[model samples]
Target chain A: MLRLADVSKRYGPGHWVLDRVDMQIPPAQSVAVLGTNGSGKSTLLRILAGVTRPTRGRVSGAPPVIGYVPDRFPAFDAMGSLAYLVHIGRMRGLRTAEARRRGQQLLERLQLVGGIRTPIRALSKGNAQKVALSQAIMVLPQLLILDEPWSGLDANAHDVLAEILDEVVRVGGSVVFTDHRESISGAYSTLAYRIEEGRVLAVERVAPRPRGVPMAHVVLADPGAECPPPSRIDWREVAGVAGVRSIDEAIHVQVHPAACDGLLMTALRGGWSVAEVRRDREAGRLGGGDSWAH
Target chain B: MGALIRYNLAAVVHGQRYVAPLLFFGIVLTVFTVNDSGPLANIYVVSASTLLVSMCWLTVTILNHEDPVRRSIQSVTAGGSSRVLVAEVVLALLIGVGLTVVGLIFPILSGSHHWDGSGLAAGVLALATCLFTGIAIGVLCSRLVVPRTGYSLLLALVVVIAVPLTPGLPPVNPALRLMSGNRPAGELLYPLSGYLVVSIVVAAGCIALTRYISVRRE
Candidate 1:
């Protein structure tokens, strides 16, 4: 178990960011820290990840190697996504062959389009988020900390991220993440720790998959010189393809993972590139642009 | 530590900010030492001082290459801010070593000055003195010690200009005095070695302070 005892954080004698907070994080469980912005959620996550040391307190029994994914991955890395993940894997104690293998596996599973070979600087927000999530998971860290992990993920990517979290817990690794609302992280986390006014309010248990059934959302490249923008939709009964709509000159199609292959193949066959494939499987959120600016 | 070193190397290479100091150092050394009959010790002194100042400028870029968000990601991945800060210094110093190599060899290859084994040894010591002194000044003015860029540049300019002007205050000053008198390498052994030790102490102090501040700041 990882524990924080009497932990406190302050910036130069100002108001407490986190005050005398005490908590225990056990393995094989997913914990979500819920708070609005500036509620000390990020500070708590940083301390748990060992990136920022608490001003005064003890963090004991932390895993030797902890993985951290910040709110947004920077858009200036020189290496492509695959290479960067491999480098991260090496630092986490994987051999070169093992690191490369695992990195490729994670990227494929996440369905990151054109992400493997493109420099991170060229990647869109949703693609960069995929890389960020993949880097942490590729290492298979026993302790994983993510800050606003869903900020830039699209519908299909969202579902994949949830599945990744479940795998982390299933493997007996702990997942600790912060989100502004319970509805955002509620579907994946097993335990909830809420932060209000720089203090841990209480611990609440979250039921598994309490959110609704997940639907796949595929966002395709904007129609332009690449492909003419479709002004109207004619195909209503394409198997697995649900609710086709146009937003910002791009087409979005909803599907379930179990029946998404046919639509994906048809899109590829039509010379249209897939910009993002994410899952829209959260409670009360569907069909919105997940690509935030880098 | 090796992995951290490798990661910093990749950033430095991508950032391409190092080329400015390196190019400036090469040009300064070439114009000052090329086709001169001045004594070898004087030539080395010019190269040494030039290198010291260039390394200071180079250090700023290396340490600040990544934005804050990227820096936090690296800190978490590498395990702590201390390791990240240490790796930045080590990488800067490693580049300084390369600059020193070019400083030592470029003049000799140009065949502009008569040289000897003792002169070469003395030149090496003088260059080492300047290298460490420059690094100390750079680390002091970096984000670790001072957060704002305007202040960092202002301090760097003041120190680079002020340190050389104050005779006997810094090793570079005394080393300059030794070469100006056309002194033999034998006469310089004790003084240059002592100055190098002092410069190294200053660098170590700066590194320790920067590491402490980085670890505690966030």
Candidate 2:
């Protein structure tokens, strides 16, 4: 088991990011860490991934092979995605030929759109995230840590990510991630906790929103003038957006009640304004109706 | 270890960060050697000095090539910060060997000189010392120590200029004074070897300190 004992982390003269905290990360489990912005979720993952040392704590039994995907994947413009993957794979202990081969396979599996030769900086943000995920899973690490892994991924890539995490647990490797969506944490994770005021608080599984009922109909504005919104191919990755129909440049979403909060959070986080939300007491179970489809 | 070195080398090379230092190397050697009939020892001093500044610049180039996010990912895979730092030092040394060879050769081609096996051997020792000294200062002034690019560059330039002028300092000042007489290569061998030893100790100490500080910074 990987574990932290009496972990307390504080920056100089600042508040304790984590105080007298302790947790166990057993193998074969998927763990989710949830917190508001600045709650130190990233710091905790960094310490657990062994990328950074805790201010005060003992961490032990960390696996021999580990993979990490940073929140913002640095898209180095100088090298292509395949070349970057190959370099990272080799650093993770794969042979040159194996690294090349494995990188090709993972990119294909992740459904990256750009050809292998495209520089990562030129690829869309979602594609770069795909590349980041590919590098980590290429060698089948004994431990996997991802920060905001679902951000920028589309619906298909979201499913692919779920399958990948399942594979990690099937091999008895542990997985940990930090995300804001409770439904995501609730759906996939065996254990989940939210950090508040430097403490990890266990989140009881919220009973799934009214079974089969389309609990909410949400209308969200298109992304602002700053950047183009994600294309349709990848639009629903955040919060399992089950159905999307465009009405006068606004997105009309009929979502399962359980995933409604996640969808709203993701939409807002993506810079889309939530214009309106209706209870939709007259609607049926989501994802089952062509009525909600464009 | 091989993978780490290759990755860093590839990053710097592809980024074109090494161009400035290599260009500096080419220009300095060309200026110091062309049309000079000086003794081999005097020419060798110039070669050694150029090698020092060039190595310092190159070492800093290689170390800071990766941004923080890329570095953290690599660190996670490499298992520790020290391994990454060691790979960087090893990469710098590999490049240093190339510089040393260039230093040993270009002078003979451009200038008149009397040289033999002893002269070649002393050239190797003197150049090796400069390589170590350059790496020491480079690591000290690199982002690992001084993070701001302007300050880092300023610190590097100041140290590179200051070290050679410090009297009796191994490999720089001592080598310059020894070469002042244009002595026979065989006569300068003993002192050059001693300077090489001191330079190695200094380089090793700097590497250790850098490794420690980098680990803590994360």
Candidate 3:
């Protein structure tokens, strides 16, 4: 378990990269650090890693052990990936022979057995990242700190990395990681937070991007009434704001994406009563115009 | 203390892989004959000093750097006290003594009875000075560079500086006497025990400062 209380950090005495970040991570849990570029996601990771100090607050609780994987894995010349993992194992207090054996096994599991002896500097981006991750998980610390753990990984490698994460969770370890793309597939997260403007905006779930083509149609009551003009419809008033296409009398009205509730309310208030509303499940199907479909 | 020692030892052994063998070879060869001592004398001094300093720096810097920059180890260090950190520093010093013994054993086995206790102690002191200095710098450098590189570079810097300083010993500079507590000053003021006292003081100071600064950064 890890608790960050009133944590805040400032680089030059003024700008706070993290301000009053209060969080609790229970044992055997996983939390993803989400944010735009410069959103303080990495800064939070650094603070957790102890590489950077927080200007204020305290991090306390269980005698936390960490398995840290840095963003850029700087490898030495002639250093094999397997050898690297073994060294980390030894660092974490494993016997030399055991370290070596585990290192070999980790490489083989990651599909890196063939490249075990290859100098780390020579591996591809994804392979190098795997080497970095292998070192992080080798020790199985109480807490695993991973910065962009999924970067440079191919599909298969991604699965391996995800499995490693699942294994950590299964073994009663806590994981805090930062990633640009969604990596947790079909796994229910214990806690999720999105960082924006140096603030962690906690979300219950980060839904997947809508699949397939987007379809939406707005139904107007009184089938014989003529459709409202484009200029008068005020498409900008919608939240999801798919453009408003022509409304065919006694038939259908086309819309891109789903219409915002506010827009629907506005339409209702404007004396346009809705008979029905249906949204397209596919993402890109609302072709050729930015208007809402009825 | 044992955990810290283990961490340091592992990092040095593994991290050395990143550094080319040519670098070590060059360092050992260069340290050997950089002085006015004859070729054999130079060989002896360089070999002992190289191994001693390498082991010392490797142990000290890696231990400090890995913990401070690595989230796993950093949490432990930050969570612990200066006392624990100081224990780690002392362990490195002990290792320094061990390396000096190794250096002495090498020459004695090769049939050089000229290995004096005072000289061996002096070498160890010099090595200790370098090792502690490397650890101190590793603590400071972690603020600037990544953990692994920060420590490796700090060790490298100490070795570079030691190349010139280790060879210049008591003969080239009078300050060496201060390090050994062998000055002509009153024995009461600077007794033989003074050397150990000074070593402990410096090592402790470095450890505390490193711990304080690193925690502040945290």
Candidate 4:
């Protein structure tokens, strides 16, 4: 278990690049570090990697056996991929043979068998990223800290990374990774945290918008002809339809974030009719209809 | 600890690609030999030049190549202190042994000089000392603002030129001649013991400094 409490960092004494941020990741769990640029995402990862110093904070945990994958690939010029991995493994106390064996295996697994003997300078960007990722997870570290791990990966490479991460988590390892892309699935389901203006905010739950086809469909009424299909109207643009409550015969009831009564009253007066509407006072359950029901 | 030293030495020596160090070694020897110097002067030149070049090679190997700071931190976090220690020691040994061989190889191979026992010992010591000093210098450079290879090349160039220039100073050359102990080149070169002592002390200081820096900054 890794716990960061009251962690803060300031460049000089002026603005805090990272304010008092608190976070915890349980063993065998995976967390996504989400934030806009300059949100202290990289800084936080560096602090955990023991690269950057936090100005004021108390971090508690075993010097978390952390495997760090930096955003930028810092390649060693002369060494080949095989030599690099074995060297790192040996540095971590494996025998020369063992290190070499592990290196070869990881290289092959990452589909870089051809480049294992090739110099690092000669490798392409994707190949180099594979090398970097393998080195980070070479020793099976307990805490894996990755920054922008999926930056340039194609679909296959992304899948391979996901497999690697899944294996890490399966073995009771913890992970914290940051990425700008949000469409990457499984991030919302797992532990998610957002960094805004140097403050780390923990997201307890991420309720994803209804996927596939939302069963609780929305119907808009013209009160003149038959209500148009739910697909015809852009659900997002229509003022209160986004927070859909429920569906009745020809009426789509929605709970507006601010005041629902005004829009409902306007719709009623404007003769954009609601054939049926039932609003729960406290629960805010708006029973609305599907266009097919009429 | 001894295992670590050996591992570091092996890694350093073997870190090269397809006899790359031999390229630099040949260049240094060729430069002096191609000049007006005879075989005898060339042999001495080889010893001094190897001592100078080996240090620079070791410095780059430790800093830019392996990057002790990043490797050490990675290993520690990976729960492999023993491995990190071994790699470092092996690197140091590789530097020392590598220089020693390069220094003695050309002299013995070319039959340039018949080394009496003291001459051989002094040559060995000088090579070892130079290598040790290089490792120590590399450790210091890791902490400083300068890039590893650049700093090492600059230092090696200065040492190669400056050490020889010390004897050319008028008032000091006379006194320096007395303290020369009959071995003019060896005395002109720094003492081996001094290099060894300096390497150990400096390496230890560097390790401490790195740990302090890492913790303080973290």
Per-prediction DockQ comes to 0.41, 0.54, 0.16, 0.25
Please provide TM-scores, in order, for all candidate models, with all chains considered together: 0.82, 0.85, 0.60, 0.65
Clashing pairs in 2: none
Candidate 1 vs candidate 4: the TM-score winner is 1
Q: DockQ for model 2?
A: 0.54
Please, what are the lDDT tens digits per residue for candidate 1 over residues A193-231?
A: 888877886665422433356667787764467566533
What are the per-residue Cα lDDT tens digits for candidate 3 across A1-294? 578889888875668888899887787777778777778887888777655668888876744557777776665435567766665675567787898888888777777634788877788777877787777766777887788766676545655665677678778888888865432311324566787777777765434224344546566654233755422454433433323344554223444333335456767666676777876444433433232331
In what order do the candidates fall by DockQ, top score first?
A: 2, 1, 4, 3
Residue pairs in candidate 1 whose N, alpha carbon or C atoms collide under 3 angstroms: A155-A278, A155-A279, A156-A278, A156-A279, A157-A278, A157-A279
Error of 1 at B84 (Å): 1.8
* TM-score of predicted structure 3: 0.60
lDDT of 2 by residue, B1-218 (tens): 89889988888888898999999999999998988887877888888998899999999998898888878888888887778888999999999999999999899999887778888888888899999999999998889878799999999999999999988776677876786665788998998889899899999999888877876777
Give the range where candidate 4 chain A is weakest over 10 consecutive residues by summed lDDT: A285-294
Off by over 4 Å in 3: A49-51, A182-190, A206-294, B1-95, B98-190
Task: Identify the candidate with maximal lDDT.
Answer: 2
Model 3 C-alpha lDDT versus the unseen true structure:
0.56
Lowest lDDT sum, 10 consecutive residues, model 2 chain B, at: B175-184
Which prediction has the highest TM-score against the true structure? Answer: 2
- Candidate 1 residues B130-185, lDDT tens each? 89999989988888778999999999989988888897786778777886676688
Q: Which stretches of candidate 1 lie over 4 Å from their true place?
A: A206-294
Report backbone clashes per prediction.
Answer: 6, 0, 26, 16
- iRMSD, model 2, in Å: 1.2
- lDDT for residue A149 in candidate 1, whole number 0-100: 89
lDDT of each: 0.79, 0.82, 0.56, 0.57
**Taking chain A of candidate 1, what TM-score results?**
0.70
